[model samples]
Target: MTQPEQVTFPAARADATVDAVVARMRALDAVLPARDGVAVFNRVYLTVTEEIGRRLRGGEFPDPRAATALDVRFAERYLTAVDADAAGLRPPACWRPLFQLRRHPGVRPLQFALAGVNAHIGHDLPLAVVDACRAVGCEPADLEDEFEHVGEILVVLEERVREELMPGPDLLQLADPLTHLVGSWSLDRAREAAWAAARALWALRHRPDVAGEFTDRLDAVAGLAGRMLLTPLGHRTPRPR
Candidate 1:
């Protein structure tokens, strides 16, 4: 495998603030190619973060401090995964497929975007929940509202992305394998799985071994779905409009 492209994001450290995360994402947006798969996902995620930041400023979250902590921790997981990939170290199972398939000519931008969503929500969100819980000194139940709110934003974003990226009416034939391929993944299912995983991890927190094993399994399962989403169709597909 080739060394991944060098895209510098802020280090995922104890003091990594949300502003720093947004700044790093913006930097990535400025430098990465528009057509790059990771760039596609990064743009969508950056939008989501910007919206969250706006909401935070608007006093939308019931517990603003908790929300900020959750958002920053959630983003750090994705950044950490990317950093690991860049260093040629093993990333989490969910992220490996995207990093490996990032430059494939046959994969469409929408596929790249959706695959990143899958890995983040499926594998990263649940763990991030636990991280936030620890940081906020609260239980997962306390962050439920914020979690659902963020998921709602992602659901809306996914719909718009699908609408914008879908091929024209002339290319919407059921016979096209791309149709079935794109239809296989669902953000709703991923969101549901994330909540369940969060609850399970919270329950197993005292048992580090069990929690570690469960997260590993979740990562591998999500990675499998990402790999399926990224399957190269051997033809050029329309990029997102």
Candidate 2:
């Protein structure tokens, strides 16, 4: 859509080293001053991915190959979306909000980050899970451990991002639009939902029509939630004390 003028984060196809991933994310992050929402989300995702890699190295996953397969598959969904965007084709419905609002002046960085998380967890993730199961030649149940572990790490990192970017003072008590928006979406719930959706998709794999409809509905709902999260609450004019 409109060439996605704001985001230029390159599409990643083949797997790369952690350093390479970090560099790609960091390069985009350097322009945060420009308020690129995609970059903020990319950084968050990168951090979570790095943590997952560490967990994989530490033998935390029962089946390391499955975990790696799942991670890579999950990433491909997003990267493919990016590639679609770059080609002036529509990315997934879920990613549309971030691409549209990446440069919105009234949207805070945290909102951008959370919206991206919502889109990924609610939409891309279930599909990723299905892709992983197929690639690893297993069922959804087989990769449950990796899925849950990744979700846990993601939750932790999301909290860290909030703390780092949250405006000082009592945000919760201020009746802030952001506080309400944040309440409307929960990463924990989104992760659980993704798991359920993944199982459903896997079960209906033989029924492509049913599976395709389910995925479309999921993407649209996630996109709606993301748009709500990215709603531009105009900046308050500071009172002259």
Candidate 3:
């Protein structure tokens, strides 16, 4: 349950930069045990953020400024949740499952990683788009190109976990529960849904009441998906005597 000591440049600052978020992830990576579920997710996310940084430097994103803003905002949400959980406060519904199950012995690292991915991509991405739009003085459509590029970078995380974390095709049967769990969610679909949700949220911004309700539902649905993803596939659960 312990997070690392404060990063020199916290991501929560008004003028937060992507570097600050990266630093925070590095700090968490350094302190969290490898087996901890949050740590597993953090490791995957750290790799993803680093890849985005590289892509940004390489001018892969057409709008680097917008991309940076979106990335920073997106990361800040998750870091804030981590801080909240560390402080014994409840995180958003989408994030609650991961935090609650972070230390569960029955869940596999892949489940932890994907469940975190589910919460972040499904819930945080849309809100981050809006926050970034407001910060950058643009609209959600303006950030679509940037969003797509960032998503492509995120796509790598799934590919990586499948290759590195899977029990192997030879050992993992087609009917394996782990296989089904991994198959149940699709990151590409999630990314598309997030984009649509962002657009919908932007359209509903004028009606805060409706928008708030929409976001609440979004959080709940994503949390449900996370709960499903975190289903224990291991034999760690004890049988009745």
lDDT: worst 10-residue window of model 1: 1-10
Worst 10 residues of 2 by lDDT: 13-22
C-alpha displacement of 228 in model 1, angstroms? 0.3
TM-score (all chains, Cα) for each model: 0.92, 0.88, 0.92
lDDT of 1 by residue, 1-241 (tens): 3234666554677877778889888887887778888889999999899989988899988898888888999999988887777677888889888888888998888889999999999999999999999998999999999999888888888888887876655544466676788888888988999999999999999999999999999999999999999998766444447
Flag regions of model 3 displaced more than 4 Å.
1-11, 235-241
TM-score of 1: 0.92
lDDT string, candidate 3, 1-241, tens digits = 4344452233398688788789899988887789888889989998888888888888888999999999999999899888887766788999988888888888988899999999998899999999999999999999999998888878877898878877666433465788887898999999999999999999999999999999999999999999999987765223336
TM-score attained by model 3: 0.92
Q: Local error of candidate 2 at 240, Å? A: 7.5
lDDT: the better of candidates 1 and 2: 1
Ranking by lDDT: 3, 1, 2
The deviation in Å at residue 116 for candidate 1 is 0.4
